[model samples]
Target: MSSIQSPKKGTHSVGVARQYSGTAGRIENCQVGVFAAYASRWGQALIDRQLYLPKSWAGDPARRDSAQVPDEVAFATKPAMACEMIARLLDEGTPCAFVLADAVYGSDHSFRRMLEARGQAYVLAVRSNHTLRFLEDWSLVQTDPGTMIADLPAETWTPLSAGEGAKGPRLYHWARLPLKYQAGQGFSLWFLARRSLRDPGAIAYYFAYAPSDATLEDLAAAAGLRWAIEECFLRAKDDLGLDHCEARSWHGWHRHMSLVMAAAAFLARIGADQRRAAYGKQNETSPKRPAA
Candidate 1:
């Protein structure tokens, strides 16, 4: 966890105009979400992270040297760090079928291109106002891309459960619209949206690239995988001390985060095994039907 100093500096601690906060606000809002990665369902127990070294800390060679921060310790943007982590995970043989993230990473065109260059498909969320080319000539399109999707026949919107939530299944209405972008082989681009059945105006938008064979169900499933990451964050922080790090230096941050991730992975493995065993037992006790 880290702090931001400037009030006009950080928008929730991510700079507004690509700048860092000053000391005052950082000291006030002190603790922040320690940037860390939890395993995707099949990901390994590797700890991949990059620490954000504030200019106040990074600029001073004396503090850097004291904390054993190496000479190569330089400031890096969050998106750059996320990309670096993803690249390293890929190099380490992590199985990545698709990429998913909120607007922070999704809004970066360069980062999206980087993933495409690696031949990976993605379903990234963006704010409602985020613009895209619905047609080859977007200017010529009569209706807004969002309106185009919204105006689709009611039958086109599928009601589905994204996953098992605390109350049972998390259900929503989803629709998609084909965009004019001709992507790489075996892939196609589309605009995906999800709206709550209870509130029509409440909608979330996503830009997706997936195999030509991918269905709305498939895209929805990929989009829902982020919830698992959220669960892991809660588990790591609440049960495993993920946010309790006292590290101030570059190396110290890495060491602290790595250890926390390791412990979190351990807890995750145990929980997964328990669920599997219970599932197997339930199957064994269920009644079998005679052949028709």
Candidate 2:
């Protein structure tokens, strides 16, 4: 068992974001989740999930003749705030490793660059249409001319399968491009190609990077781990009622979500302990003793 120290006074941060349906009768609020990661095996710890009220929610004083409607509706711009919060957490001194995120966060170049500037490693997803130059060893092509990496041609590509059955659909095709881009200096870059799951005609592209010594296989595996974050979201929503809560006000909603995250963490710990105990018992070869 590991002893808990006073929150290990260090800077480590993880940022989370959720998209809510902007429909009629739904509260106009910005729903975003942010967390911190300490230098432990578990990389992310739930810090807060907040809802910002919109200006429309503020009640009109002239409407005193009508029913009293509450003023200040919850509204938030998730992407920008999420970046700010993540930067704040990293500024606190936490080492970065393996940032797992869904496509919403992954599609943002600014967000990814923010992590990169902090010298953090990440595995983020990108939509199929994003464009990037292929990286290739152009030394053989040019004598003394300085060759730009982004203008190089793609030499190879690989398909990533992520659908139902063996023949369901192709999720994306990715290739390692050996070109140099200013944004990815000191790191290697790969081009990711994704097609629409439903309509096979649509396609997208993105660039992924890692330290120069990193291999293509390693980058793919790291990106694959992003699925774990999806599982976490499923557990939170399905088991912990992240989206079904009845809280209407911004403050109430934030407070409830925070509690739910805490409960989920506790339950996960309990489940881990039980699984470990069961595994240990099964591995033991000793015969069961008879009761006296």
Error of 1 at 235 (Å): 0.7
Give one digit per residue, the lDDT tens place, for model 1 in 1-292.
1122223323232211233333332334342332434445443233455556556656777766766777886766556667777777778887777877776676667767778778888888776766654444445544444666667888888997776678987889988887777588888888888889899778888878888899999888778765566666666667867666655545665676688777877876777677666763536568776679
Off by over 4 Å in 2: 1-48, 52-76, 93-95, 131-155, 158-174, 183-185, 194-206, 273-292
Q: Against the correct fold, how does model 1 do in TM-score?
A: 0.78
- Give the Cα error of residue 40 in candidate 1, in Å: 5.8
How far is 19's C-alpha from truth in model 1 (Å)?
Answer: 9.2
Per-residue CA lDDT of model 2 for 114-219, tens digit only, reads 8778666665665544444433575333321112223335455455653323476435544455445564566655554444546544544334666778766656
Model 2 scores a C-alpha lDDT of: 0.48
